[model samples]
Target: MKKAVFLDRDGVINEVLSSRVKFVNKPSQFYLLEGVGEAISLLNLAHIPTFIVTNQGGVGLGFMKESALHNVHKKMIAELAKYGAHIEDIAYCPHKPTAGCVCRKPEAQMLIDLASAHNIDLSGSIMVGDREPDIEAGKKAGCKTVLIGDESDNFAQANIVFPHLLAAVPWILEELH
Candidate 1:
């Protein structure tokens, strides 16, 4: 079994827009948050497989086309590549929150599927996210959870918490060793 890191996309990887326009609808709307490149690059250098598990309900709501999301990912990938970072795979839930899809956060389906596909050891993996649902999913999947933002409500649930992804990197690397 292999260990891995799972990251939530929105607030963890890039800036989350205001409530009115919450999704990155186009490539231009996507921007890697500060330290994201260096953080991911370090993970790459360590040979840790990293993946993105996100909820993109905007697709189901028709806020943006799937193609647009692809473009946004392309932009993100290019940006990360500039720092020698790479992502192993990406899994997302396109269903609306009201749809209650199994792939959505708070459900372990996406993590389970990825773990199965990648032969990962869930107990040895880490799931990093900015919200409570992300922590819930990690718990369901039996992985250690790291919260990237100050969500007081989630502090008890997360195995660890940090102000940002870059700040969490050292601890994450320590855990792997």
Candidate 2:
């Protein structure tokens, strides 16, 4: 099996919006975070397989249609491609937090399912995120977790913490070596 990197989408790859909707419901609302393209480009150049695993509850909650999510992903991919970055796959749980879905963050089902489908070695993989649930899911998936954001009680569960995803790239590459 090959090692890979899994990333959380909202805050890690794109700017987390502070609006009434609070989610990227449309392509226009999706903006890549600073240095995100460069960071993912670095990983791509290293031939590392990268994936995005996110919890997009807005879809299930009827806030946005699935087609809107696809459009947003298309925008994100197009922007990243300009920097030579490529994502192997993108997976999301479109269920509300209270839906008890097994694919949600804090549950390793998404990662595990992706790992199985792609032949990834979860133990050798790294998961990077900006939220506590992200770290928890990575830990549960047996991946080395990196938290990108302010310190929190659950953030302590990560293998390491960084101010942002760009800052964590070097360490992630180092571990892969």
Cα lDDT tens digits, model 1, 15-91, are: 87754345688887787888999999999888889999999998999998888888888999999999989999999
Which residue pairs in candidate 1 have backbone atoms (N, alpha carbon, C) closer than 3 angstroms, thus clashing?
none
Lowest lDDT sum, 10 consecutive residues, model 1, at 14-23
lDDT per residue (tens digit) for residues 105-132 in model 2 = 9999989999999999999999998888
lDDT of each: 0.90, 0.91
The parts of candidate 1 lying over 4 Å away from their true place are: 18-21, 151-156
Residue 101, candidate 1: Cα error in Å is 1.0
Quick one: RMSD of model 1? 1.7
List where candidate 2 sits over 4 angstroms from the true fold.
18-21, 152-156
Q: TM-scores, in order shown?
A: 0.95, 0.95
